[model samples]
Target: MRYYFVLTIFSCVFAYEKDLTFSVQAGKTDCFYHKVLPNEVIDLEYQVIDATHGELDISFQLADPVGRIIVADYKKSENAHRHTAALNGDYRFCFDNTFSTFSQKTVFFDLMIDTEENQDKEYDEDKEMEFGANSAESYMMRMRDISESVSRVRDNVSTARRLQELHSAHEARDRNRAEEMCAKVMTWSMVQIVLMMTVGATQVFFLKSLFEDRGSSSYKKLIPGLGSQ
Candidate 1:
């Protein structure tokens, strides 16, 4: 009985979840498709993390099996969408960078498919088998209470994982921006330093030239009496 309980918990904990990171080159479109069954729930979240030209925006679209657009966004930095499958077929989603001529976009996305009904049905069937030998009413009630608690914990874990992934992606995007800004500032500072050094050197040379005579003949050209001395 204990072994069966552990197995059930493991099954519930390991649900269907996929996380991916990819790059979409400039003036190109990348697409993916997943097969889903009717009544299954699909959750999608995506963020543009980094870009070559510092433009953190991309076009996104989700289409149903019949070529109907169910969710669409234009030049968005980050967005999420949730939908329930109505038909059994391949659903397509795409990331478009066609609007960018020279920038490549790096994107992070999460996809989750939830079949709560089927999970519940399987749990119920297992519960009946586990309790069939022992018909005590109070015992069955107690087991059901435990099952509910476990289900709640499973849901909380899933939510927490999703939130953690989103936070990580946000941190990465911010870090990239900070690094780019730092590089620009450093480059400008170096250029200013070089210009200041060059100007100072020119001023010093000019001041020295005023006090030193190049030759007696040259000095005599400026002062009429210098050649006689």
Candidate 2:
């Protein structure tokens, strides 16, 4: 029991570490990258100060981890309002210069990421790395391309393992909930059955007493009166 408790605690801590946060100085009002997980929500707070004293209106376009653009908005937006991440990878936050075309401007932003059920994916990643080592040299060469691509694949595998662990945990929780519900239903059914039986038994006894009383009354009425005799 103690070992189980310890393992559970460690798992929780490991999960907490999967969520990421990053802050970048105002470098460009063009594009930024944030790695997030599937089904997770990321909060992006961008503060662009007009250093050049230029009136700049900017909008952001969100990209999936595969560099695919998802959400595009030309209108100004405040801190990301509970924005849900579409995929489990690095998402791009693209800022567009709508009004002013300054030579070069700086934009600052903070990304707050919360991964969803990711700890399970890391297991798959470790196993993949072990397998990757034995692959042909050609395969390894392909893996090394773009440097960023390799990193992306690694991250994806990690996400997969984290998700696997979380999936099992979720199943266990569901089973526990189902068991509790079943027990409650059984207790309630038993109570109802006992109450019904008690009520039926009482009714039968009352009916028997009524019948006996009626018979005795009839006998008294039929008996001859002693004074008249």
Candidate 3:
């Protein structure tokens, strides 16, 4: 009986991981719909990586249960927003790449729902420990210990995710800088090649002119009286 109760408590606090990885075409908007109940906490995190152009960010918006836009960001590469549902209905998160005429983007996002039901369960457990007739004090204390461990796990996961995102942003910046440098080097090399070819052709023409006979002298000798002068 004690073992089963512990299992139930652990299950109540465990959170599910939900994520999406997809591409949005140019000049289009893609949206994710989630149904949430009143007073539930919504935690959302997302990052957009521009695949085609440098610093090509995107826009996003969050709508409430009544379809009123609440959170909005423009030209953002990465952002996160969290809000509690005020009423029960569908919540919308949208990614807008419509500003880009020909460039598509890759987006990654995570959505987590933290319900009040979990809090209620924990409250009930505390009440049971305080006033129950046959509750083992050791079991109750163990349950609290396990709950604290779960909270720590959640915090560690959040920290790790943020660190990974920062690293990704750094990498993207470096990659863009490298590509720009390469393009400039290639253009400069082509210009040098063209200049060298032009100079070489000019030198060949000057050398040919210096070596050729005046042909004017031959023309004068062909006319009989012109040679005597």
Candidate 4:
């Protein structure tokens, strides 16, 4: 029971992963920040999942705590970045869609902060406790092995979850793009059908007018003596 309680606490402390989706309107920028400690590993992945006018691209920028740009990507559909925090502060992420006048972009992003130092410290603290010189030593060793195995499993699960989320985002983007293309194709096909019908009607009316017989008054307008004849 004690081991389970400690494991729960550990999991809670390391649950700083985030998955987010938001919109960046045309001529505007959207920014977010996450607080991180020094030496923590930061993993960021983002994709422009959907957009108006088939424009699935946006500018991304990441800035350090001291306002220095650590990474910048221009007009990208998807990107990922990994960095280690050198100072303790909030890291800024910005998505820029200012180049688009009327198209808005929908973005999906994943952020993960891994504190390996803290995990190592916790492990060291567990090791510092002196075990009795008896059967308790073997029991303690078994418990430690169990804890380590659980931690490994947890890490694997986290990685799998992140990959699944990213795959889902990609699927959504592709589905939206396909739907948009289908709509455009249908609209243009209808437009072409309407144009063809209009041209056919116009040609028929012109031919009929050309073949029409003129009355005596129309002839008189063309030749002065034709009406009398």
| Per-residue accuracy of model 2 over 1-229 as CA lDDT, tens digit each | 3353233323422322232222222434556665676666665555333324333235677778777766666645233434776667777777665455442333444455644235335433543664666655464344334333534565587567555544554454456456766888999999999999999997886676667766354444546563354
Question: lDDT per model, in order?
Answer: 0.86, 0.52, 0.75, 0.83
lDDT per residue (tens digit) for residues 22-63 in model 3: 788889999988888777788888776445664557899999
Please report the TM-score between candidate 1 and the true structure. Answer: 0.82
TM-score-wise, the better of 1 and 3 is 1
Q: Model 2: which ten-residue window has the lowest total lDDT? A: 15-24
In candidate 4, which residue ranges exceed 4 Å CA deviation?
1-13, 131-135, 207-229
Q: For candidate 4, lDDT tens digit of each residue in 1-229? A: 4565366336533647999999999999999999998888889899999998656899999998899999999999999999989989999999999999999999999999987567766665655553422346665666667667777777899989999999999999999989998999999999999999999997886676566676525446546887676
Candidate 3: pairs in clash: none
Off by over 4 Å in 1: 1-14, 122-139, 214-229
Runs in model 2 lying further than 4 Å from the true structure: 1-29, 66-68, 75-77, 116-229
What TM-score fits each model? 0.82, 0.37, 0.75, 0.82
- Model 4 error, position 132 (Å): 8.5
Q: Please give the RMSD to the true structure for each candidate, in Å.
A: 5.2, 21.9, 6.2, 4.5
Using lDDT as the yardstick, the better of models 1 and 2 is 1
Query: Which has the higher lDDT value, candidate number 1 or candidate number 4?
Result: 1
| Cα lDDT over the full model 4 | 0.83
Clashing pairs in 1: none
Model 4 Cα RMSD, 1 decimal: 4.5
Query: What does candidate 1's lDDT look like per residue over 27-121, in tens digits?
Result: 99999999988888889999999998957999999998999999999999999999999989999989999999999999999999887756667
